[model samples]
Each structure stands twice: as structure tokens, then as C-alpha cells.
Target: MVAGAPYPHELLPQLVEIFSEMSVCIGYNTSLDLGFLDRIGVPTEHLTVIDVMQRFVDYLNANGGTHRRASLSTCTKYFDYKWEGTAHNSLADAKATLYCYNMMKVIK
Candidate 1:
């Protein structure tokens, strides 16, 4: 969580509003995150979700790398991204996911 950020449940209305304006949501394990958002009353029905983990695995398979599953850490390491923050921190993890996605796009 960021400094002075509201808790998920407390920010439901703002989250819904923000998500509604977005064309798509991209994240690692996006289904899980969307599910949690849905459970917390955030509306995500209109959003298309792009999961970086799935994209990474598909990229690997298509490029002759034999990876069955791709975690955030694995993808970041494969792309040689250095981690500067604690693992599992949401903001850091999100940054890593975006970096991995951009790398995949470059490779494609």
C-alpha cells in the first residue's frame, strides 16, 4: 500500500470510478486480482484484463523456451530486471509486471 492510501474496502466507489474510465487492466494473475476487486464491490465487468503471466508463458513457448508457468519473479529475472524493493509489495510487483509486459512486446 502507498503512503496514506485508503483500504480497498474503503475506496470501493473511487476504485469503481477509476476502473470504469480505463479501457483495460493489465496485471500479473489478473483474474485473481479482479476477483478480489469484484468481491470488494469494484465493478470490473467492462474491463478487459491482460495477464502478464499468461503472456510471458505464451511468449516463452512461442520462442522455444520451455516454461510451463511464469511467475512475476521468474519473468522479471528472465528479463534481467533488478528488484529494488521487497517481494510481494503490490506497487513493486505491479511495476515488475508492466516491465515484463513491455519486454514481451519488444520481443514479439
Candidate 2:
């Protein structure tokens, strides 16, 4: 996880460089995360972001599942994924997001 305060001057350049090289960034609530990054002075205009939460909800609703609002925990539970570590931890959340994405992809 990114420790320290947001938009540390020492980290901005490196973040910009890394983001420039990335084709797409994936997150649970990507728009919110991107807004945070933008507010923190990270250049996100060139980055394409995928919101796994939205996709997961859409998938569930389109299928037989009745999920009006799907949380990370709900999605993981529905997919039968055993979550390790604490909830709300960025690393664990990322892993869970990936798992949800993979499972949804298989359905598609």
C-alpha cells in the first residue's frame, strides 16, 4: 500500500512515470480513486481505469443474481473466494478485486 501522506513530492514524479507506462488501471471504485489521485495532483488524463465494482454489479444483475449494490465482501463471498487479511486493506482489496474480475470474465 502507498504509505505516507497523499501527493508527497518525492513520490509524484515516480507515480506519474509509472502511470504513463500503464495502459489501464483497475480498481473497485475507479472513478472515486481516480478523483482522489487527480485531487492529489496525479496526472490521470491518459490513464484508462476499470471499475470492478460496477462490472461485478452489472454482471450479477444481468444474470440470475439479485444484487442491487455489491460490496467487495459481498462479491468475494458470492464467488466463494476465501479472503485473507483485514478488510479495507488496499493490498487485500486489490487481490479481491482481481479475483472478482477473473470470475466475472469467466461468466462473460
Candidate 3:
């Protein structure tokens, strides 16, 4: 499903609720992926939002490395990952974001 914007309130909560009912929702690379869910009134306690940025930072620090930028898109570009498509749909955008996030580790 595609959200109208990054901050599409209606879809976010619906997605969160669906995930909560199904299983723990997991996201990669994007720190703010679930922020919309919270901003649109999804309970933080009801869902889990993992910041892949923080996780990557921890991994980098553990291996004596550092990230130059904070944003996933920037980090992806800095690491030479390519996203060749527009982020029009939620799932596609999520996959692209994960690809970039995974590329960081792959580059390392």
C-alpha cells in the first residue's frame, strides 16, 4: 500500500494496528519510518519502532568506525548505495530504505 505523503496519518495507524495484530513490525535503515504511526496517534507501547541509524552507529562504533551523516538517504549515498526509484508507495519506499541500510553494512 502507498501512503499519500511521508506523514500520511490514516495509513500509518492502520499499518501499525495491522502489524500489532499480526506480529512485531520491523523496519530497516529508516529511523522515522514509524514516526508517522506515533504522530498519527498510534501508541508507542503498542508497537515497536527500531532506529536502524542507532543500530548502525552502535555497530560502527563497536568496530571502530563512524558514519558521516545521520539521514538514511545521506548515509546511503555516502556509502554508494543507489535507490533508482521514486518513493511513491509505502512498501516500495520501505524496501528502498532497507536496501540502502543493508548496503551500508555490505559496503563495510
Best by TM-score: 1
Ranked by lDDT, top first: 1, 2, 3
Residue pairs clashing, model 2:
none
lDDT of 2 at 69: 71
Q: What is the lDDT of every predicted structure here?
A: 0.87, 0.83, 0.58
- TM-scores of the candidates in the order shown: 0.84, 0.82, 0.53
Backbone N/Cα/C clashes per model: 0, 0, 0
User: What residue runs in model 3 are displaced by over 4 Å at the alpha carbon?
Assistant: 1-13, 28-35, 65-69, 87-92, 101-108
- Superposed model 1: Cα runs more than 4 Å off: 1-7, 64-68
Model 3, position 53, has a per-residue lDDT of 67
For model 1, give the 10-residue run with minimal summed lDDT: 82-91
Best candidate according to lDDT: 1
lDDT of 3 by residue, 15-45 (tens): 6667568434556543365565556666556
User: lDDT by residue for model 1 over 57-83, one digit each (tens)?
Assistant: 888898898887778888899999987
lDDT of 2 by residue, 11-36 (tens): 87887788779888888878788887
Worst-scoring 10-residue span by lDDT in model 2: 1-10
